[model samples]
Target: MIRASGISLRRGVKVLLDQSEFTIHPGERVGLVGKNGAGKTTLFALLQGELDLDAGHLSMPESWRIASVEQHIADRDRPAREFVIDGDRDLRRLQDQRAATHDDDGQRIAELEAALLEADAWTAPSRAEQLLAGLGFKPEEWLLPVGHFSGGWQMRLALARALMAPSDLLLLDEPTNHLDLDAMLWLERWLVSYPGTVLLISHDTEFLDAVAKAILHIDHHKLVRYKGGYHDFIMQRAERMQQAQIAYQRQTREAARLQSFIDRFKAQATKAKQAQSRVKALSRMQLLAPLKEDSSISIQLPSPTYVPDPLLTLDKADLGYGSTAILKNVQLMVRGGGRIGILGMNGAGKSTLIKTLAGQQAPLSGEKVAAKGLEIGYFAQHQLDMIDPDSSPLQHLARLAPDVREQELRNYLGSFGFSGDMASNPTAPFSGGEKARLALALIVWQKPNLLLLDEPTNHLDVDTREALATALAGYEGSVLLVSHDRHLLRSTVDEFWIVADGQVQEFDGDLEDYRDWLLSRNASARADARKETRALQQDDSNSVDRRTQRRQEAETRQRLAQLRKPLDKQLGKIESQMEKTGERLQELDLLMQDPNFYTDQYKDERPQLLAEHGELSKQHTELEEQWLDLQEQIETLAQSDH
Candidate 1:
């Protein structure tokens, strides 16, 4: 359906892509995989004619219409139907003009008729409604103003528009970025059954593996096409790289032997001919490129000073917003060293309940408490907001943690990729990946007994994201996580807590199984919702019950506003501590350099100095334990509410 031959995409001197050759057959489902800046989005733009490639021929059927899902959506005040139909901007504009004026002139009338027929203006509303409904938007929500929705819902509208149009090929860029678990599964099914060709770029590994029949790897300014699933592609790349390494090694050995032969035999004419011929052959041989082996990302989480035995407990817990509660009369006992996954849709009250579990917020009209040793490390989804860009990591840490030594602090920063000069750089200029890494490293450094991570992998590169996941999996403490990254959830978590429309569903299984169950339950949930909506509409009152509706809506919106800040502030303490410790560690390094400094200190201070150091260590550990306990408790609460 689409083909890019010798395609080279560049901006000024920076080459985004170079001579990439690939072909997409009609009705093919292809996963475009690459690193963060490997031009997956840029390639899609070139094919859609949104961006021009530097060189090469891009050929596809002239009649084929292409659709793309843009990342950002602005001006969401219009209704869902109107926003989707607006994709055909010219048609919508002409219709607006026609509605405002009584221009019976032949030129305008004929033009309007032609445009209306081509754009399917009369049926656009029906199509838009159906597409939105299939994407989980309700019939009642069809008329709701888009301005009321959050970023996640706005993304859904963009995707709905993209899917609404009849296109021969679809190019989706991070289409599942803000999607919850259920919505992601629905999209996977749609892609699997879609009639047109699909090219999807996403960070979701499981989603890619589930839907992609072929993998198109964009790497090192070239295209590495593999004709199979994502797993097949991984193995293929590994094998290809291995073979190249072997060939390169063999060639290098031959080159060395030939050079040695030339050095020893140049004086003998007969032997010289052989040596010279070998040199020419070496010149003709193209040097095998250096092997680009995939680098593994590893992190060493700081150990706990004092672990909590019982993380959290809830007896008859009624968690929700206001009196119209969500999960009611529930009992849950969460022990320490727990690893839990909170799964649900956008308005599931997962956050509200989780906060209650953390003891940072209270459950509505219910009894909830935590163990004494509970130290929580709550990492909110938007945790980076607490970090100040103006200060250096060192300065930030010094202000937050007074007891940390300078040399120890630098060592912590070094482990997280901020070695030497990088640690001294202003944090304001840090990329999203760097900031995310700093957040995770900082929190883990404090050695919290329980950790609550909310959407930690959103803007991270695949390598860094997986590293974070790996570290979390290896953590000895308890954990509660709210994330859309299925790979991370599946690999790291053993239990699933699903939060849906004002109810929580707990299941004992891996993420893969949970996904299967969710897909099955989704159809049933839709049917029940539709039936309920119809019954409510029959009443002389509004479409949905006002009290029930307000409670449900407020859980997501109002609670999001209240808790986003405090949780982020709590988690930022780790980075704050790390920065201080780094500075202290550096200071100690300087002092230790002077051989007489330790001897001089010992002369004045003996037991008191040693006692103070012990006290600092004891304080740091106690704080970490409390932070961890709180984090786990909150996470457990999130699961229960879900």
Candidate 2:
């Protein structure tokens, strides 16, 4: 366990955190949430002892071990397994020395054996593999050189190494940044079941909601604590704020009336004491200024004109890298009026399939025939690679679309949230999301018939997500695209194509259907895992069996316990959440009341909070039901006691 008491962090004169207090207990998963550049990373650094505090103290068990979800990996050429083992050099050295001795050095052997036992070295490799797989890595990927993977995959590998490490505290900064949805879900499961304390910084709402039991908010150089998940935190924060608001209003009105009376009768000897008393009350009253919560998703999107008719088609398409077929013979078509989504795992050939049709890559021994007179514009996920670092956004737009007027170009970029001083700045300075949007602007400026897009919404905000969804919905050409955002895919794409097992197949449905199928698949996998674990346990209590079977059963039981608690507790948590959500709605109502709606407050924040609550309610209900079923199962298993 670790605790930071009255901590204040400062950089020269600027304070990052002021008088912050937080307790991180063993097995507590905490999420640090705030806007970009709001000290989330800085907090992690402070916790890791990489950043010094200006005041107060941070304390933890002296023997506590710490590991970071390393953002930068130094071992590029090393095997992934080597990286995992080498996480703690002392442990690795002890294991190696212990293995080499064959009764050659009795005392040294004894010492090494003691060290291995203390380090739990016997189970380390297996645990590493398990963690790696949980983080969406295949067994073979463990042997691949870290340098060979993309930046995203490399980050995941680093994170995998850290998760595999035996540590008392895990400090993760933006751990969800490079992960696809599958990997994110995998990480979430591990975090929830993990016995160690976790300090996770992530922008993914679903990840935080699922894994974090407590939320630590860093804002305005101050830290605040809420005793539940992200949704609960927001709701609790809202309710408290609303209560404070009502109290303040009532007090302020009384003070104002008293002041009026004093002002009217201050000169009269009979009323002077009453007037002064009212003024004193006003001075002592504490004002509760509202906190703005919706700054993260505010984005300006431009509406585009739609063109008519089907823009392109793919006939008997085969896409792959070199002679190795990533996708077998595939047939696909996109009509002008409908939105389409391409879905798959990290290496599922979704991008490659689109690339082959767009002429970015050649198919393996198969023809990709596009419709006649089709003008195809392609935006690859690696569009940033195509950008000339030296060119400005304006320069790039001008070079790509020479006929467009400067004002038109500026307007286009502005629509995508690159406006004013930001528009003329060098494209090299833009963030990943900015670069992605700029590339999109370039692709759409050409007015091509068929659009081939790969990972189009990788780093976009929710507002931009909705905006782009609307734009794609109206685009005249057919959209052959791949994106990870379920919300965007739900509105923009009409059908889904799943590329797996060296083939591409069309699945006619939306994201909702995909989610339902995945949940059922997960339930089946969970059942199978539990069954296998039990069989292995009954076979033996070897380290592997104990870890795999006994540990799993224990974890399932723990989850069951949390779910089976009294209904009063469940309803209390929900009602607490409801009060705060009601306050958030009230705040949004105020924002909606404004015709301009351009203030610093969260205009759309309330709606998102409400939707998040619906999800939380569902999860709570499901968990409760699962608990009841598991209880019955446990009782049945113990029937021999009778």
Candidate 3:
């Protein structure tokens, strides 16, 4: 368990936490949430012991291991798989020790080998490859040098490295920021199955709802604990605020009554004692602070002057870079008020199609038709970079509408959360969220009939994201959105377009259906690869002499059997252990389900039972992973035999 008792934390003059206390039990998955700059990251630093609390003590088990993604990765010519494998520090240390030991030292060598096996050192490469694959890296890319990738890909590598580590606690800050829909789904599954305690900071509400079991919110320099996921936290917090408001109103009425009595009778000798007593009573009352809600953004997308059916159309489009096609023979149309979401794996031509439609890139070999009054407001991450840093939000808007008055421009910017100084200040010092809002503001100011948005909610906070979704929901124009944020997608889009296998087509279902489709497709691909491997092996064998082939096959079987014997034994033992652990967990669940088990009658034994349950759960998760790894090894051997 991790506990902070009345802890006080500060960053320079800013007091982020003042005597705040919270406790996180073992194996709990927690989401740490707050507005930007509200000290969510600072709290992570405090937990890692990189920063000290000014007052009170933070305590956790000394033996607990922690893993977190590095903010910066050196651009080195190191194999990506090897870089991720290094995250397993214990495995690397064991390998190093073995290297330093002499072969003649038989006993020492034996001990090292046993230690390595216990640490799963031999399977580290496969594990690293699996992590990389889940994070959107292809098999061929795994052997490439880390420096060969771009910054976003480097961040994905960093995330993979963090996930590769064996730790008792995991801290992920915006882990999904660099991932696409498929990668994000894979990560959600990984985190859900993770046995350790997790502390995550993310603005992606759907992700938090999927992976977080609890929520830790930072508000008014205090850490507030809620009992469930993001949606639960919102409801619970709203109820709490409502209760507080009621209490404050009641107190106010009482105070007014007391003051009325005092004012009415203070001058009379008849009620002097009562007035004095009322004065003390009023003084003794603990006043409740008025509730202050976070300010919300209100976005109004200017209505288009004209709406035309089939705002844009693509015919026999081969979309890609020069001389290379990503999506071929694509035929699609965007009608007025149509809402379509583009879905695909990373580098699967979603962006290519958008770019072609936005006229940022010409179709390699096709024709695009646009309505006479068609206007497009294309917003991409790169557009934020194109904005001049020296200009303010108002200046950016003024450039878009040169003849508009300054007050009108400022008022329009204010609707997008840029008011007064924020509207006029140079955007050089603004945060990513601020820049994204400004970019959207500029797009909205144009009143385009068609909106082509690519990952527009990447840097937005929860409130801002909600605002955008709400605005887009009500906007009277067509929308083509590509986003990993499922909440935004569900709220804003009505249909889906899938880009895969160099073709573009309409998908028949929702996001859940897409996930199932992706999983099934991957499984089929793996099966095909195995079949191809077998076919090639068969051809090679047919070329050899029949007698020689028989002899070689017999020897290979004997060698493979010898190799599989010990692994089979280990696999059985792990399976037995898993069964036992799972039974115990079921028993604990049954006991805890009894309403009386949590009452005072069983209070003395509850902690022990809960602790045992946590330990068993963690053990079961580790055993399951071992079981999978063993299966993979057996499968590899079988493939080699083929």
Candidate 4:
């Protein structure tokens, strides 16, 4: 267990915490949350012994090992797997010592081997591989040098290294920042099953709710611990704030009444003694201070002046870099006021599709048609960095709307959290959240009819994220969001476009459905890979003439089609039934929402409706599972034939 007693922490002259106390038990997963620059990182630094407390005492089990993702990794010419494996320092040390030991040193060699076995060194490589894979690393890239990976991939490697460590405590800071939805899901599951205690700093609400067993929030220079998940914390904290507000209001009224009596009676001879007693009581009274509400920003993007019926259209487009097609045969249409979210694995062409739609990159083939008087506002990671650091937010907005009034621009900037001197100060020293706000302000200032936001919430805090979601929800413009933020996706987008297998198509499901599909796809992929390997090994020496092979392949495909006919027919029937069942269930759900549906008069009918609803739901679940299994089987067989 870890304990902090009367701990005072400070950075420079600013005191973040004054005599704060908290206790963390072993195997507890705690989430540390606060506003950006609220000393969350400082607390982590203090725990890791990189910084000392200004006062008081902090203690934990001295023998426990700690693991955390390194912020920076030097460019090294080492295999990625080897770099991850080295995260287990004790195992590496033993291996290194064993390599240098002489044949005569039998005792030392035996001890080293025993230590290696205890460390589970033999399975280290496979464990490292699994960690890397879960973080979106391909099998072929496992042997590549660490220097070959880009910054985001390097961050993934850093996370994988931390996960590879055998430790008593694990500390993660925004582990899902660079990950795609698939990778995020995998990491969440991995962390949930992690045996060690975890203390994570994340702005992702869903991630915290999924993984954190407890929440430690920093409010007004004090640490407040909550007993449950993030949602529970939010609800409980709100209740606490409400009760505190009542107490504070009551105290203020009592103090005012006491003062009023003292003032009125002080001049009267009969009440002089009472007034003096009241004075003494007033002086001794402990007044409760009103709670300070958190400063939350508000964002409202301006609606476009004119929204064309169809904003843009893509016809048989092949999207990618020169000579490298990432997404092929893409046919998509964007209408006014449409909201679409793009979903895919990392490097599976989600960005490519966004870039192509945004006109940052032209399609290698086919046509991209924009409606008359079309305008676009594109926001990506680069957009944040593209803001002039030497200039202020006012200057940036001024550049976009040179003819607009300065005060009006300031007001607009203020809504995005850049108020007063913040709008005038140079952005060079601004934090990431500030820069992101500026970038968004610039984008919204343009009043474009279409918005393409790629990971817009990356540098945003929870408040800002909610504000962005609200703004996007109310904005009357076409939006295509490429993000891993599930809450944002759910709130903003009405439909989903999945970019996978070198193609783009509308997914007939939500984020949860996409997750299940990813898991099923991954399993099918593994089975296909194994089958391919076996077939290749057996036919290693076989060769056929090109023309003869083409004919045979045609015939084989025809035979496979015939074999798939019954399964395809059964799938059609199942899908038709599912569609009808879904519609009927929705009707029943709506009917149940009526005010009089559960009243005494209709109570008899309610049981029948309830029974039918329950039976339908069970039938739907069984059918859905059956459909999934059959789909997987068909896919596996199709892949085997290919």
Best by TM-score: 3
Global Cα lDDT for candidate 1: 0.75
lDDT of 3 by residue, 1-642 (tens): 999999999999999999999999999999999887779999999889899889999999999999999988875698999999988999999999999987555556545665887798879998998898888898789999999998888999999999999999999999998899889988999999999999999999999999999999998888999998999999999999999899999999999999999999999899999999999999999999977677789888888888799999999989998799999999999989999999998888998999999999998887999998999999999988977899988888888899999999988899999998989899998878889999999887878999999999988889899999999999999999999999999999999999999999999999999999999987887688679879989988788998997999999997666556666778899999999999999999999999999899898999999999999999999999999987887776677688
lDDT comparison, 1 vs 4, better candidate: 4
Ranking by TM-score: 3, 4, 1, 2
Judged by lDDT against the true structure, how good is candidate 3? 0.90
Which regions in candidate 2 have their CA more than 4 angstroms from the true location?
Answer: 10-15, 96-104, 136-141, 233-255, 258-262, 267-270, 293-308, 364-379, 385-415, 419-430, 437-453, 456-481, 487-492, 508-642
Clashes of each: 35, 1, 0, 0
Model 3: residues with Cα > 4 Å off, grouped in runs: 267-270, 532-642
What C-alpha lDDT do the candidate models reach, one value each?
A: 0.75, 0.71, 0.90, 0.89
lDDT of 4 by residue, 1-642 (tens): 989988989999988998898999999999998888888989999999999999889999999899999998985688999999989998999999989988555445545655776788889998998898888898889999999998899999989989888899999988899999989999999999988899999989999999999999988888899988888989999999999999999888888998999999999999999999989988998887777779889998998999997999999989899899998889989988899999999889888888888888999999999999888999999887698889999898888889999999999999999999989999998888889888988987879999999999997888899899999999998999999999999999999999899999999999999999999987887688679878987686366667887898898887556546656777888999899889999999999899899889787799999999999999899889979965975685488586
Output the worst ten-in-a-row residue range by lDDT, candidate 3: 103-112
Candidate 2 has a TM-score of 0.70
Could you tell me the TM-score of candidate 4?
0.82
Question: Cα deviation of 590 in candidate 2 (Å)?
Answer: 91
- The positional error of residue 416 in candidate 4, measured at the CA in angstroms, is 0.3
| Candidate 2: clashing pairs of residues | 339-494
TM-score for each candidate, following the candidate numbering: 0.75, 0.70, 0.83, 0.82
Comparing 3 with 4 on lDDT, the higher-scoring candidate is 3
Model 2, position 135, has a per-residue lDDT of 62
Residue pairs with colliding backbones in model 4 are: none
Please report how far candidate 2 places residue 286 from its true position, in Å.
Answer: 2.5
